[model samples]
Target: MAMEKTKETHPHTLGECTKSILPVRDALEVLSGKWKLPIIISLMFGNKRFSQIAKEVPGITDKMLSKELRELESNDLVKRTVYDSIPVVVEYSLTEYGHSLEIVIKTLRDWGVAHRKRMMVAE
Candidate 1:
């Protein structure tokens, strides 16, 4: 004799739902704020100096860019390197851990495109 299998269950309690969403909350905590995502996208292209990142992300101030970059670096999502030269050069790039966000970013980009198209059609 064998035990009969029942259908799987979904979270039915508030605590269960909260527990299920903890990972998403944690990810958002690290990536939150207006500048973090765009900064990350800017860095995905390649290593770039501070000025380059500011230029790439429109409407961002030098101070804000510097602040956001520091936050990203502290979170292990971005790496900053300084080069030895006549003009001291510093560059920013994503870490291997940061590269893990590629798929998430791409998915958000795809959804955004589709959502914009849908909104245009509706309007």
Candidate 2:
């Protein structure tokens, strides 16, 4: 209650805080879960087939991968291409919008490495 009063006093600060939170929450909604980031990272290297993505991410079940890919595709973060030829080839790659995550992913990788080192040092 006190904090709400304080926030109300600073309308600009409250608006900024609320504005940032919704997008962050929405992003987390799309990127949450164990497999989504790994799958996205895999596609970052190059376009790949379903089996290839499975190989890269590792430990992810086929059903989960398919589900994740569909979600990613729906979000316009991944592009799925179907080639009409022998065996009907399909490939998955990052969309232009998806490439926007490059810096965010790099920052996460750096943070993860640092956190691991910090934990090891603490123990």
Cα lDDT listed for each candidate: 0.91, 0.94
Worst 10 residues of 1 by lDDT: 6-15
Query: Clashing residue pairs, candidate 2?
Result: none
- State how far residue 4 of model 2 sits from its true place (Å): 13
- Residue-wise lDDT of candidate 1 within 22-42, one digit each (tens)? 999999999988999999999
lDDT for model 2: 0.94
Summed backbone clashes in each candidate are 0, 0
Please tell me which predicted candidate would have the highest lDDT against the true structure: 2
RMSD in Å for all candidates: 6.3, 3.4
Which residue pairs in candidate 1 collide?
Answer: none
TM-score against truth, every candidate:
0.85, 0.86
